[model samples]
Target: MKTFKSILAAILIVGTAGFLMSCESELESKGTASIGVTDAAVDAENISGVYLKVNEVQATAQGKTKTVVAFDSPKTFNVMDYQSGATYDLGEGQIDAGSYSELRFILDEGSYVKFKDGTTADLDVPSGTTSGYKVKGDYEINSDSRTNLVVDIDLRKAFVKTGSGEYKLRSTARIVNKDRSAVINGTVSGNTADKVVVYAYEKGTYKESETAEPADGESRFENSINSAVVANGQFTMAYMEEGEYDLIAVAYDENPEEDTYAFRSASEVDMMVAGSLLSVLKVEANANINVLINLDF
Candidate 1:
């Protein structure tokens, strides 16, 4: 349980020889630390708002975890509104100058998601409402530098809907070093179909893989980045880490009777970024997107 100052003093004493050097370069000194949240572009077109009530924010270093900011009570954010670089500031505080290995957030009840059909349901965060959701990352906080972190709650992989209509929240948060992130913006056209979804999967992903859910404590990492839903034919992929990616847009049939879900995908598009440029791409859907599903029956 070393204070930020003591940790910095130790690093200075060692002249930041090894890991400390990398961390020091990546972290800030005498700067403020803030936590924000963003969405990973879900195809939940009917889901308008996914509000989460966060109770406490904590950071850990040197084997000791401390609450950086505890809500006087609790606060909620409609996660859907945070997309493509958009974020809801959880809060800010003086970050300790140490090698932080993890970050956690305690959530409370009163979390729910609303739908476009005027229906709303509770978002069940199994054990998360009281237990908290945590993820790992390296953070070095110096005295005068700003350290900002954003959490990517992959709504596509995190929010699961069961046959019995149970809404579950899986622990699938991706922490990002905000200063080193990029954004992707795009648009969809020739899509007259309802419930058209656009996703940014890692290149070489199988289209059917979208149905696979992550294990309780696993990352669904194989090209599973979801895309922000299109608004007025425009879409955005925010807070992306540097890498190559493939984009796919699908329009699904909502018929409940069929066990198999039928959908159409747009022609694949490729994306890549090495630095901080907000990349953009255009994806065209299959020409028959306007076809009626019931017509087949």
Candidate 2:
């Protein structure tokens, strides 16, 4: 009877060891990946929200692509509400450990924009729902580690007006590992911050036009290095890399077709870095950049 009991105990120990080994092996098979979606500053007057349905998020690895995680049911997001560095976390999932080169978003149809004037317009996609909007960036996934990837949607540039009261969708996305990106936020208070169009040009960007026939420095051809709409006097331009930029604020004189615009710069602020929130002065990683735009037009 004692011998039988010893044999049973050994069997149980062996079974437990096998189960533990199997669990560890399964855990090492994949890595944790979390993705977040955010929007850049979008200034559209009386525009309450721009909504789109995200079908799926795909990742490309070693010349092959797969859906890391997907919304079982399509998820709709208001791009305007997500502005000012606000982000929507898509949660985390496990993916094979490796280097990923590209991230693609399948933005399906059923997109629309709401105006505060009690009007709604359907956002048209030139290509329909056939293709996915892609942002190319590199990221690595290691075993038992978290890889955070962020995708910033620039609504100001993405939503383009066509002919009449219609608009076409052309997505312009910026993908970055959370560690390498930063946000720049501020308030443009003065005559009309909502009417102001702010531009953030690189350090070496020209104060003078590089092309001829330059119309008062703020040429349509010049194109500010980075531009965003000042919504209700509050604005934010996210995903600015680590570098210096010159801020140029412009308030246009009413006429929609008129080219007349007023330019204004802050009293004592110019340069900023990435990874932290900047209010008025510079912080370690990000910054909040407030510009009191006194438009004298």
Candidate 3:
């Protein structure tokens, strides 16, 4: 009886050791994914900052979700500060080496927007804490290598004011492999409008309805792949995937009293003599393309 009990104990100890070894091996097989966030220019007047508190970032691979970045405490970021090709690193974590189909950002409360006049209003994120915001794309993580990713949040289309005189987040964001994306930089001259915004759409994706006034709680150019506000006669749309895109320049009337930029009209491009030969601009990975848009105001 004593000999049998001793053998049973030894077997239990061996089994436990093997289980721990398996877990360690699984952890060692993971790769590191470094994530960051960026934003395009917001198309509103007197807006000083857009703040967001991120609790964590998760990735889904083969229908299994795992955290790739977890903060000790919720990290608050002024997303507006990372515009025009700038990014804010959200830190890194280990993820299983595989192809992820989607990435989500879990946010916390206390997100708000500050205006230039020392006033702030709560920016509500619907289902931000529960469902989170998702960015769908194909991302590959190799074992023992670090992959860099940047989440581009186009604030122009994302920030909307509700009927109750409140603001809410209806964001459109995309995750791109930092090393595999490109940037579009250009100058907009000969403009007489109060403001100029450049919108980039996938080839042949722009529609006349996009220029129409959006319904309540919506904004124009909602379907643009990305957008940039002309600043000091220059504009930049970064982290764009390699493909052909159509550029649309639009004019706006800035009303500082109401803190709004009302849509005016879509500007005509100077087709004959501009930086880009064609309206359809071709962008390549890891390259910068300059497109000049001389608006016929």
By TM-score, the best candidate is: 3
lDDT of 2 by residue, 1-297 (tens): 999999999999999999999888778968888888777545354577778777777788877877777887877888767655567876677888888887776777788888877788998765445546666677888888888887766665566555466766564566666765566665654444326666666655545443243332123314343466766766667656666666666554443454223333222233333434332333224444344443433
lDDT against true structure, model 2: 0.63
- Candidate 2: which pairs clash? 276-285, 276-286, 277-287, 278-287, 278-288, 279-288
What do the candidate models score in CA lDDT, each in turn?
A: 0.65, 0.63, 0.84
Note the residue pairs that clash in candidate 3. Answer: none
- What candidate 3 gets wrong by more than 4 Å, as runs, is 1-29, 256-259, 268-276
Residue lDDT tens for model 1, 85-159: 788899887766667877778888778888867788988777666557775677666677677888888787677
Q: Estimate TM-scores for all models.
A: 0.67, 0.66, 0.85
In Å, residue 1's CA in model 1 sits off its true spot by 42
- The better-scoring model by TM-score among 1 and 2 is 1
TM-score for candidate 1: 0.67
lDDT of 1: 0.65
